[model samples]
Target: MITVVVFFSGSGIGTSTQMQHNNQASSSARERHPNSQIPLPQSNYAKHESGATRDSRRRKLKKQKVRPEKRKAGNLEYTNERNIAAHVSRGNKDRPIHKFKNSFVCYSNNARTKAVAVVKFYPFEGMDPERKAHYEQLSTNLIAHTRFQNAKKSNENTLGGTMYSLGWRKGFEEKSHLGITGIASKVAKDQEGWIKLFTETPWINDFLAQRFQDISLGMYREVKEQYDQQKAPSLTPFYMADPESFCGHLSFTFDNFYNKAHKDEDASPFRFAMWIPINKQTGKLVEENLQVEGGEFVFPEDGCAIDFSGFNGVVECVWKASEHPHHTLPSSTAIGSSDDRLGLSCLLPDSAERAIERMMAVEDGEKLDWTIQDLGHLHNDSLKYDSKGKPFETNDGVDLQASPPSACVLDEDSSTEPDKSLSSQLKVATPTQLHRST
Candidate 1:
């Protein structure tokens, strides 16, 4: 049976930065935490909405207008390499200090009517004090998690992206959250070494707690405030990865993992989402964004590509997954250095947090009249699928295939679940805004 869940955030929904600190990434792999010494981001970013602000369908967009204290941030310093950032007090009173923060620009598919925006604040967002605090807390939480114990390195430790996941394998089964038995190998295991950072954050539940309504509506408010448009689509944002952390992948020499052009999983919200990455050496907790040499995100809907190689931190208003075909260039072919990639991600707003609570309810057997979009388990760590959710071949021109692991961490042949890739080929169902079941 296929269930579809759709949550829409309408015009009556509520609402919810910028500047540059051109600080280069640090040399050491030390983690960062909240300290009084850190300066706040300098941007005039404030958003407020009430019931009175219902008609967003015809709202008009204004250029980036900053207040007295706020200044438009400088462009990200493009470099020959990539990295994320934390604090290293120069203590030089004469020199200006720069910390990472969020910034955005508004746009439309046709450059005319309905508008959407790209919101970015990754590696850091210094402008909003509240969000900055949350970033600090999140850093601290991940740092603590990574310190728990030594990890068993996988035998397949080879070249490619080094991302990891911390959730159960049976994502669609009842009590699936309890199914945590699984093993990772190769580049994934390398990334898994830092997996605790995601599994142990204090607000992880808040991140995973988003529902369709929260996402669709949040996108609405972001675009509404920026473009003053009357209508926002019901874009249900799901974590690019399942209820887990797909920390990151470092595109190494000859590794075909980072170059392919494709889309991310369908649940990702295109308008106003954050893309945060960190230095592989900086430990798991810190968010030190990298400006990868060739990692420019290509947008199909708009025919544009953004190069993060120069940007300090990322906070973009991306296109909805359903509407766009996005891909990045090959990561720099460099050996282990500050450019080596790794990072944690996800920050669900108020609406999405409540959706998570409702998900818990559904798991608890409270039947609601909602369409359950079943985005069957894609095994987030696999290199087989490109960012566009399409199959990819390695540098050797071979398709890398592996079965999803069993809940008990058994061999490939031991998988107890059916492969959704085959099931999806059968045209599973009419995918809802919420999820697409296998």
Candidate 2:
């Protein structure tokens, strides 16, 4: 009978003894295989399985070790590159990416006509007390020296002539008190009163005499001498051209007006309908159908309307200028259309503040708190007028208003909501005198 023995040991004694026995058997088999093939021992098979298990463990360990190291190295490289790029971008200061943001257009409306006013609000950032005083003086002088009038010459005949010679040279002071000052006061004090006043006031005609005088002084000495010798010096020589002669013409016609009549409603400020005229023949707005550069007319886009919910006071109006047919259209047409009209660019406190901040961001690395109170610019020098029916030599200065406190940090606590009730009750008057003549 054959006898088989089985032994078990907790410390792997049995397994060790078996492995030793397998090694001896494998050596004997290899010696025999020198001349003949020999089957592998069972113990040798167990060793082979152990070797495979060890290899699999080594492979798992290698995969686990390499993956995280590669990830960490890649992360470190990315972070280092980002830091270097940011440092380089910050170090270069000569980049031309920043510019001033103090320009804006202000539009006022009345019963019969809408007037668009443009202003450039200069803040009190770097200005000392003396500079502030100087700016205030400039504003006062601009108001004091400003004037307006209806041209004496017919629109058809004065296409390229001086404003004074055209026959309209009325001073702003001589007209009714419902001018810019009056409207500004109403806006600052009583919202409802201002709304009513704006709808009822008549459009004034005026040109700045001081500005015309300045332009006259800037003329070449030779030109001045020739005019002096002829005794027929054109007082407003700059304005003797077609499109320049018709710059300040207010000819828009009104269509409708809405009176919300509530002080707390969001839509109460002012709303009006008007017709922007384009020459039916050429599909443009121009004097005598002459195609002039920068003389295109545009109306607001369809379905676009003013929203006054966030403003304390909102004023909206339409502006129309005759443009040459060959002129390229503006990229944005939100305010106007191809049929000879454009829409007014909308403004809010946040947007105006953004503009001011952007302007200040460009000047120097130094930060400034600039409050833009108002923005506007003077017309081209060609629109000046003199006492005698001739163009004025001086150029008019545009009025810019600014207050230190007007610009404040934009925070959640700022109260920018418009007077809802007052804005709602206000009505746009369509029977305005300015609309009839246009």
lDDT of 2 by residue, 364-398 (tens): 33433432221100111112322232433334544
Task: Please give the RMSD to the true structure for each candidate, in Å.
Answer: 25.8, 27.8
Q: Which ten residues in a row have the lowest lDDT in candidate 1?
A: 72-81
Q: How displaced is residue 401 in candidate 2, in Å?
A: 15
lDDT agreement with native, every candidate: 0.34, 0.25
Off by over 4 Å in 2: 1-275, 278-408, 415-438
Once superposed on the true structure, which residue ranges of model 1 sit more than 4 Å away at CA? 1-108, 115-117, 121-160, 168-181, 184-202, 207-217, 220-259, 264-273, 284-292, 316-318, 333-336, 341-438
Residue 369 of model 1, lDDT score: 35
Model 1 lDDT per residue over 1-438, tens place? 734444446543322201111232221212254342444434333244443453442242122233211211211111101122212223344554232233333234222223233434444535455554554454344333333222312314323444332322222345332222232222243333333333332244344223111333445434334221211111111122222221111111212224344443432333333344444344232334443555444443444444455555534333454454544455773455444333332322223323334443343233343222221232343344554445567799887775544332112222223234523443322322332111
In angstroms, how far off is 388's CA in candidate 2? 27
